[model samples]
Target chain A: METVVQQLLNAAQLGAVYALIALGYSMVYGVIRLINFAHGDIFMVGGFAGLLLALRFTWMPLWALMPLAMLLTALLGVAIERVAYRRLRQAQRMSLVITALGVGIFLENLVRLGVGPETRQIPSRMPTTPVAWLQDALGVSVTWDKLLIIFVSLALMALLWAVVHRTLLGTAMRAVADDKDVVPLMGVNLNRVIAVTFAIGSALAAAGGVFFGQAYSLDPYMGIDLGWKAFIAAVIGGIGSIEGAVLGSFLLAGVEVLTVAYLSSNLKNGIAFGLLILLLLIWPSGLLGRPASKKV
Target chain B: MSLLRLEQVSVAYGAIRALHGVDLEVREGEIVSLLGANGAGKSTILRAVSRMLPLQGGDILLGGRSVRATPAHELVALGVAHVPEGRGIFPSLTVQENLALATWTRRERRHVEEATRRVFRLFPRLAERRTQAGGTLSGGEQQMLAVGRALMTGCRLLLLDEPSMGLSPLLVREVFRAFQEINAEGTTLLLVEQNAHMALKIAHRGCVLENGRIVLEGPAAELAGHPRVREAYLGEAGASSPPCPGTPGSSR
Candidate 1:
């Protein structure tokens, strides 16, 4: 039972990181129907952004540093949209997909050149002593970092829910997803809405990047594996639904945790992707996504 | 001066020309219906006016100023509200949210409550279903909500494409009655319809299009009774009308 509880905590931490990164995929897909392959690089860039901030302003708290990374990363996301994706708005879907992959490659190589392809340790910002209380009381291991990850992710998801369901911009985003062509008829500038979507999505991914860096060492290529896993989570949950992305992320993490605990650790990613295929075979639209209806 | 004018406007989807030098005019304070069968470029004309499609030739003037370079979103702020062929309401949004979205371009931001009240008053059915998802509403209710959405934009010109496409005759009449009330309040209407009979009852003037060219333009009553309009659009009932005394190929 103690081992199971320990695994659950680990799963929760992993799920929170996946959820944050998956949101970027879900949101961009919801608005434009593009997979935004470059999104994973944005996550890497975010870690680098945080690294730069931490190196220069070593006195800044994690709270301030994370937001600053998100802000810079959000701007980078918007710039990617403008430079790499905007002109291809009307081009073939394949071309957009190719361009996105190209952008990801370009970002990876640019960071490799800038940072010299060496792994860097993020200066530990979160305190470790707070975990002692939980460790003693519960008689099970619980790190402050894991607890913080869960709490921050829940708070961000709640805020996202409010933005999507309770605000005017949220309404426009939903409307644009439903019908991009007709949204303009209602006097919405599609470019502005798309930009805002990219910004919010990228910012969330940046937050996830900072968290991942604190939990794990930062490398230029780290985003490739983590980003793909988060994307798989988004797809498993339902590509366009926010709730689906969260549910999918948690499920993927749970499966991965259970596999590493009871089975071969090498089988963790294989099982995560295998479960995605199995779930998709059973319910093609993911868990929470409604089947798209045809318009007359 | 006319509120909207299309001067020898031409549009094509690749090699297939939808509108070839199609000249149309809608003066202020008038309800004009563009009547045609499917593929007659009726909807294409509305698309061109809304700037949804680029004009291959000629120009579209809104109050004597050219709008050729204006984007589709700008047209609404310029006072043109286009309710597209499929009644493009955001299905996931509540009925009230759908109406609220229309006010995005309205200059009088403080009067949003009044604008929403006007929409509710015009379509009391919408008031009852204010919290319902737009997609779940019955077709007639969705149509009502679509028109109500347009009204929320404070548009001086309403461009409706196939407003009666999927409604029962009773619901169709109810919508046209609402259109009449809307026009009486000083909004001009340009509607394209396949239900020529119903559209004619409310339209003040009408134009007939065949193969991307205007075949006839006259008062609604005259166009309704024209021989070719009957042959092309009205079918069996049209054959009963007596030929005019002197005009051969009269409709053209």
Candidate 2:
């Protein structure tokens, strides 16, 4: 029972990181209908941004450093949209996809060249002591860092929910998702809404990158693997739904962690992907995604 | 001076020209209807005036200043609201959210609330469904929501494209009655419709667009009685039909 509880905690930590990254894919897709294939590289860039900020400002607390890194990474995400994606908005979908792939490759090479092909970790600032209550009563070992990661991620997600559901800017974002052409008719600047979407999505991914670095290690190419996993999570939970992404991430992480723990570690990817395929067969629009409605 | 003017405006969709040097005007507090068959370029004129499509030549002026280079979004602050074809409401958003979105340019909380209350008053059905998702509404209710949303922009001029399309005759009457009320309350209207019989009844002035040019323009009553318009648009059989030029069935 204790071992099961430990595994669940491990799954929760990994799921939190996945949820943070998956939200970007869902949001950007919701507004523009573009897959934004370069999103994974943005995660990698965010990890580096966090690492650089931590190294440069050693005295800055993790709370302060994380936001600064997010801001820096958000700017990069906006710049990428402006330089690489905006012009091809009216062009063919294939052209946009190809451009996104090119941008991803460009970011990967840029990071690899700048930082060299070396794996690095963010210096751990989170409290590493196990929870006394859990250790004494439940006889399970769960570190403060892991708990902090899960709680902080949930808090961020809650903040995002409020922004999307309660605020005007968020309403405009939802409006853009529903019908891009009509949003401008309502006096909302479509470009400005899109830019804000990119900024928020990228910022969340940066939080994920920072957490991942603290928990595990960061490499320039880490985004390629983890990014795909998050993308899959977003796809599994309706691609445009914020809640769906979080749910999908946790579900995927739970399956993978359990498969590795009780079954062969090599079967983890196969099971995770198999579950996605099986779920899709039943709910083609995704678990929470509304089926595509035809425009009259 | 006219509140809105198109000084020989032309618009092209790529190689094909949709509006060919169309000249028009709308005085303040008037309902001007543009009537034509499909592909006759009625909607294109609205698109050009709203800045949805760039003009290939000439210019559009709103209240004397040239709006030829103005973007679509800035028109809202200038008190121009466009209710595009098919009732452009955000489906996933609730009725209240749909109305609130149009108040994007207005920062005053009091003004937004006042405008929203006025919209609900104008269409009581929408008030009942305030929390319901916009897509779940009936066609009539959705049209009301669309018009209500336009009102929320605090617009001086409302541009409506095919406001009567797809609704039953009774619902069409209800929607048009709302338009008349909206007009009576001091909002100028530029309405485009294939439902000429209904559009002419509410309009003070009317223009008949054929193949991108204003072939005929006059008082709405006069155009309603005109033999050519009677035959082509109103479905009245003319005594001497001359191929019914530019009607969808006769167009080459």
Interface Cα RMSD in Å, per prediction = 0.6, 0.5
* TM-score of chain A in every predicted structure: 0.97, 0.98
Error of 1 at A181 (Å): 1.1
lDDT of residue A268 for candidate 2:
96
DockQ for every model, please. 0.78, 0.90
Instruction: Give the native contact fraction of candidate 2.
Output: 0.91
Q: Write the per-residue lDDT of candidate 1 for residues A1-296, one digit (tens) a residue.
A: 77888999889888998999899999999999999998888998898888888888999999999999999999999999998899998999999999999999999999999987999867878875557876777778777877887899889988998998898789899998888888999998999999999999999888888888887778888889988999999988999999999999999999999999999899998999999999999888899887866766
What's the i-RMS for candidate 1 in angstroms?
A: 0.6
- TM-score per model over all chains: 0.94, 0.97
lDDT of every predicted structure (CA atoms): 0.88, 0.91
Give me the runs in candidate 1 sitting further than 4 Å from their true place: A293-296, B107-109, B236-252
**Lowest lDDT 10-residue stretch of candidate 1 chain B:** B243-252
Number of the top-ranking candidate, with DockQ as the measure = 2
